[model samples]
Target: MEGRNLASINYNILDKSQQKLTIAGRLDMENISSLWPEIFKLIKKNKPKVLLLDASGVDYCDGAGIGLFLKLKEKQKENKGSLQIENLKPEFNQLMELFEPGQLSKPEQIPSFFKRVPEQIGKSLTISMREVYSQISFVGEVFVKFLYTLFHLGSLRWKDTFLIAEKSGANAVGITALLGFLIGVILAFQSAISMRKFGAEIYVADLVAIVLFRELGPLLTAFVLAARTGSAFAAEIGTMKINEEVDALTTMGLEPVRFLVIPRMLAAVVITPLLTMFNNLFGILGCILVMITMGFAPITLINEIQHATNLTDLFGGLAKTFVFGYLIAGIGCLCGLQTGKGASAVGDSATRAVVSSIIAIVVADGIFAVIYYFLGI
Candidate 1:
């Protein structure tokens, strides 16, 4: 080890290889700025394949220090280096845990309510209620603005739709399939147990058919938008915000809402139903897989589901999903508009967008449920 001792940081260049470089040091907020220029310069000069930073002696690192370190580490890829951190202290360990946390991480870990998906959903929903209730004009404006958006939508060129469909579809397909199949499996398993107790195990197929087509289709499709498409919108619009394109649009006398928001919102309106149908198909496929393992006759399962559900179940779910598409797009675009001064704002806005979309979807689902039940279709 060759030691080049600076004030608080003692840089020990441990080894050098074609594929990697190793450095061990104590990095604190107080000393970080002094070493950055030299450290950044070394990075530029070495251009190694990987950079292993052994921060075993890092006693303290504030947000600024942590921020700088993350930036340097992020630049590693462009420099052909993969930054791997080791020997983090307890505080640093807690930070990592917060960023990438929980037992969903480990199979046997049952996760806490506040930290779990349910809690996140509840929290977002509560916020949504407050927002919607706080301003009656916002709801009126949203509806009016959406109606205005619809008229301009029909005049929109076909190429815009095609570009949007390709991007939205490709982004959302995988997560939608995985989550849809999982929900289907759990539904079939749970419903089968209940139906079996009632000597109606055959009804498991009916639940999958009706419930998936009508409810889970919209629900899952909206969640997919919350995760996949909403994040993308925030990131894209965020980059635009970062680049001042949104501001430029205003200077040019163009409405950022009409030019940017309309395309994505309309795309969601068109594509979500298509995705929901796909989700329903995959969900059914998953249930079929479960059926095979449960000693249910595949032929009988098909017959019962076919007889139990009709156009209403299939079409109703699809229709609800179309509404969800609008909600997802609307919330995402709104959050993007709220993005502020920096990359941190982009990240923060994207998170808010996803959380808002999920909450909006859940609330919309409940509203739709009430409407559908009273209609008694």
Candidate 2:
């Protein structure tokens, strides 16, 4: 019964083939060795049909104690006799649960590749469908708020809208112009090489103008915005979401979508088309520079561009820019608003916003291209 003493084991022979082993005191590392000899001796000599281990008297047990029980259980199994544990403490029960053996000897059977492929595909489809539903619902809510703000002009946050426009549009002008100019220069250079073979280098001007105004201008502008402004939007809003500012706004009866999203959306819608137009102008400027270097007159280049491009081409590109802007802004806001909890969630949202916006822009551009082709524009 002394605290320093090892666990004491007492045996009670119940019958010819039945026996009980009572363990008392602590069964930890320092004390478990004392109980083993008696247990083994009884097992070897009597080889009882049933061994009942009464652990009620045990005050504490450790890993060693659990190992001892496992050894006893294994010996009982070898003798084809059952080992019945009695009066186990709740704490010991928990310990046993933690150390319990699983069926590791019997490995799990993996399904065949063909069987797994359809299952994976179905899971992917289900996830994709859920994401689509979430995005559509978010878009619908934003659209309703946008319309309401339009009708009630006072409700529109003009100051925030202007600030966002300035940041997303004005700050981006330099990069947009540079990219546009480079694209035009590259296109003209490539085209002029082929045109020169046929003594039709003048046609490079037409090619550059048509391509820049009808396709490259809008598409390039969208990609730039998606990478720059779209990611920023998501990060900014996602930070607010994590800080509980969005929830605080909600508690204060201010709709976060209306207050935060509407301004950014409007800014994108108004600024993207203007930026596209500017991109087109800069691209043409670059083409002119190239053509002048190639011994073509500036006036001649201007005339070619004027002749090759029309109102339809210009407006079609602008319309596509508008759609791309809306999608980029909307997707960014959606990703931000849907951000999960954690430090990495903001970065994840930003990345998702950029990727999703670019994808939406590309898909929307393709749809526009098909529609324009059908309409003969």
Candidate 3:
């Protein structure tokens, strides 16, 4: 080793392939400012494959000193060389550990849009396929657990089911009634305007009854459930997942689907149809008000409504509620169970639950319409 001593630091030419840098005295901003550029120049000139730093003689170090060490390591990295810090005191070693050289690496450049397009498509497709698979698997598990709960009624958590039902259904009564009433009033008023020209203004009752019973009432109720109840379920379950409570339950031999999901699903199934019926009642009340303003008696409007819609219409809409309720609850629970780590995970899960529930409800409603149409319901 050919060693040369500087004022407070030592430089050593160990070999052609390796170099040694010895740091000594107080390493602060003043010392580092001068030493930094000198070290960089030597490292650049030699481009040693391995650079060893001996910090045994380092009397003291501050933030600037720590920064200098980090910079030297970065320089070696650019030269495709390794830096080894040796003979550091425990405290200095601890300070060195606080900063990792990797953290200072230059960020990679973003690829061009054209270059990334195929990668983006492939990534999206892969994610979508995985999501579909997860949903299918969750559905199967829920179905199996539901069947088990059905056969063993005692296994269902009745208390939790009642609480969720109250929250999702009873607490939502005001908004549901208001929305349904407004919808009916709007539908009736619009229909009456068109029918008035033909001297058939009273047919507005028939139109309102048919549309609400066959389609809008249950669909709107499902939307409310998807937004309110489904989002809540997702947030609750996602929080539980994040806290590792779900894992704890699994460790304790409790099925998370059975314990957490079944109650919410049952609550949704029972409450959704009940809420739909309330929505229908309020909607009809709104229709009655509109018809009375048009000089039609309340009894007359009721008679027309009865004649316009039969049990098939009412029951068909209610049937869709059952399926909609199940899907909303199931999707919410599925999203919650799939929650990932990080600050935004719960919020993301809730959003996915609401969106997925709405999509599923619409798709299921369409399928139901087709089946009902073919069957002449």
Candidate 4:
């Protein structure tokens, strides 16, 4: 057989029914494009019964070369022929070992829609169950630490608690106030527009006061805390965890739950109610501003607010703040503690912390609503 050199490949017709191809040089992205069509054309035109690929001359190869081998095997099989690869370089063999030729050669099986539905449901259910179990386990650990900290007050990290409180609560005052003010303005305007139709625009003050005192103030503050402080907690703890600082704490006989989590939890619990009060103040100020443009005096709006809301309404909302704070901080710390290893672990933990905190807050609010309804509060 006479061999013809075409670029890096030498093509030879071994017999009337057999063909041999020798591939050499670097089979990377730059070279593969030109070589692909040439080799494909040779296989199509010759339709060899037995195709031999001699790759010993190949000095370097990458993923593109692996793909070419797989495609050639498939093409040979389509022509009812056989492909044999011989004398491949050890390094090339090592790279090719990552892929299973048999798996790549076979067409991927796609499940029917009905089969896929059950598989999807199974995956979701398994993930949800694991999440629930993790939450329960973390909650138990937190509860134990909480009791221990309560009795052994000296063990509590007051310095860290105050520092966290300042960061999570004090520093967030501006954004929290702005959010409260906007919520109040929007609520007043929306309600005033509807109430004005009945010549009851003055009643917008009462509506704003009741809603802000009973719901929106605490809820909005908690949301801000979750988005801002909660995510930070997760990211910080996750970084420390992945860096093995948490393990070091254990080595020093310091409990991570007490040292890391308790401080944050305490800070959140203390600051949430305080922040809610600020939210209530700013929201009321916002309502007053809206009412002033609507031809109502500030005193008139204040009197109406006092008449519409009771201590119970104010206290009930504030109660929710404490729970919201606890949930936000606790869930954040839990997600951080559960962070997996990887470069992306810290980011993923932060995302999970925010999502989990928001969901827990909403669910807790719903439960509180149900409890209040039953108690006639």
Candidate 5:
């Protein structure tokens, strides 16, 4: 036989009831096709009561070889005899085990729904705790890096910071102004209806100024940034992560958090308050327009606004914007850095960033309200 097709079979008739079949060579598909037919013919002609297959010399095998052995075993059984496999190499023994019918046939038990409920709850709680611990640790690391970079001004990317500021603040002015104007119009229209009955229509200025400056301005600005800039940060960082750009930064001894996150955080901190101020301006302008249509002079509306709102109200709103900005940018960066592998991961991170930032802003705003009430701000 050619060396390329090197399968060979030898039969030794030990006795009337016994025979041995020795197969030596590669038992892959090509060789098995020619070799199996001859081997089966010998077995059928001899009609041995007991057959022993020696497979120690098999250097390679495939599924066809295993199928051949199973066929021989069945043939021997049909002849009222037995087939025994002997001298199998470790690799071939593993192959034989794979074809064993009982390997994966174990019966499985189904759990009751009541038992599964607590089990699922426990698993979910464990996963949530682990995620909380990881997030806390990551936040701590980012804070330490931020403090270090504060002393090393050259380490900060000033250009990136300014670019983010412009994108998050300047580019968002149109939408912010439109939203603020509409909110102001709605508030004035609704309040004017009630106030005109009591002959207190002029106090509409006080209501609009107090509500906008103390709450709506900062809250609405935060909502806008959380939806726009926050989602952008998460998507940008998540793409970097998937492309291994973050890993490359680590390999080059650069801190990804400091390089990527700090600039965005600082920009948000500077821009959000400024945006809130602009939103307040547009909101008051909307109220002015409404009051002018109601037969009040522009000067009269301005005077009422000035008399009604104090510096404390404006400053309180600005202060809340700062906190909201930090939370939005920080949460966005956190979600991005924590992105898992996959194409869907970027979308998921962006969604999580927006949701988490909004929740944080709302909770923080409530806490601020409580604090201001206690401090009499």
Candidate 6:
């Protein structure tokens, strides 16, 4: 967030103890370095049983700052101590949501893996999966009616489709590019260390290209789209559900599933793979640029990149995007279709849709990973 806002963070300790330390101020981007020294100093001074980061006064915290909290948590845990972050604002709680793997929670909520296993396993996504298959199957019937409603090629729903496409693709231009670029840089940068040890640093280009094009591009693009357009689609449909428009369609002998769900599902099917392909291409650009900046020749980078990734991998990645697209749209629309008759229900459905789609995509990716790894595809 500091990078986004062109700002920084600086925190201080007001009171200290063998087991706790009261901290103050915002942990933004700029002043993080200054704050790090202070934290280490406290660690050196008392090696306290635990670090109680007093974020009671903290107004905001960015992603980078979350690392600081994690470090303190880890350090204390290593010594059989516990770290506690007190007085977190409600808004800050969302940032610590389980969107990513291994996010932290309140100190009291921490538990051993064995104790957590049953709870985690009990939270099955089977209900969500059933909803998706049923709703999306209903959508397929609607698509046929929709196609025949207008002309063979044109439909009244084209505007909605276009709007959705623009929202999902056009508006996402900057962020997608940024994500792709970052992915390329990260892939190559990490590979460079190992490649350099073997005196084959140029393979970093191949590493970046293959990884980005074959996996990261589609996964990241679909993930972001699920967060953006998937949520919006679910919210809009769910709102209509709560407002009785769905009921009105039923009364009028029209199916809400046909009119609403199918168009959204089709739009996602069309757009997600295109977005994923574009992501891989742009990420390759970033990879090439970064490699050249690191003193590799452009021609060498291109040659190596081409040789590294197979046509099968390229096509396989595109296929994964299609499956991911289906999962996101189906899950989102199903969630919307399930919305109860209340305004609050619409919001809850939207939030749940995004979260569920992401989880499904990630889980599906793991399944794909296992298939590819074992089958040697």
- Pull out the clashing pairs in model 5: none
Report the C-alpha lDDT of model 6 over 73-139, residue by residue, as the tens digit. 7778776767777776767756656333375565686678997887667555666677667766655
For model 4, what is the alpha-carbon lDDT of residue 331? Answer: 88
Q: Report the lDDT tens digits of candidate 5 across residue range 126-219.
A: 9999999988987898778777777887989999999999998899999999989988888898999999999999999899999999999999
Clashes within 3 Å, all models in order: 0, 0, 0, 0, 0, 5
Summing lDDT over every window of 10 consecutive residues in candidate 1, give the lowest-scoring window. Answer: 1-10
Model 4, 94-119: lDDT tens per residue?
A: 77777646754567788999999999
**How close is each model in CA RMSD to the real structure?**
18.4, 8.4, 8.0, 5.8, 10.5, 19.5
TM-score of each: 0.61, 0.70, 0.74, 0.79, 0.71, 0.60
Off by over 4 Å in 6: 1-156, 373-375
Candidates ranked by TM-score: 4, 3, 5, 2, 1, 6
Q: For this target, which candidate reaches the highest TM-score against the unseen true structure? A: 4
**lDDT comparing candidate 4 with the true structure:** 0.91
lDDT by residue for model 1 (16-98), tens = 74333333354555556777777777777776566666667666665645655576566786675687777767797676545
Model 6 Cα shift for residue 318 (angstroms): 0.5
Best of the two (1, 3) by TM-score: 3
Model 2, residue pairs in steric clash: none
Of 3 and 4, which scores higher on TM-score? 4
lDDT, residue 366, candidate 1: 90
lDDT of 6: 0.75
Stretches > 4 Å off in candidate 1: 1-157
lDDT for model 3, on a 0 to 1 scale? Answer: 0.90
lDDT of 3 at 26: 76
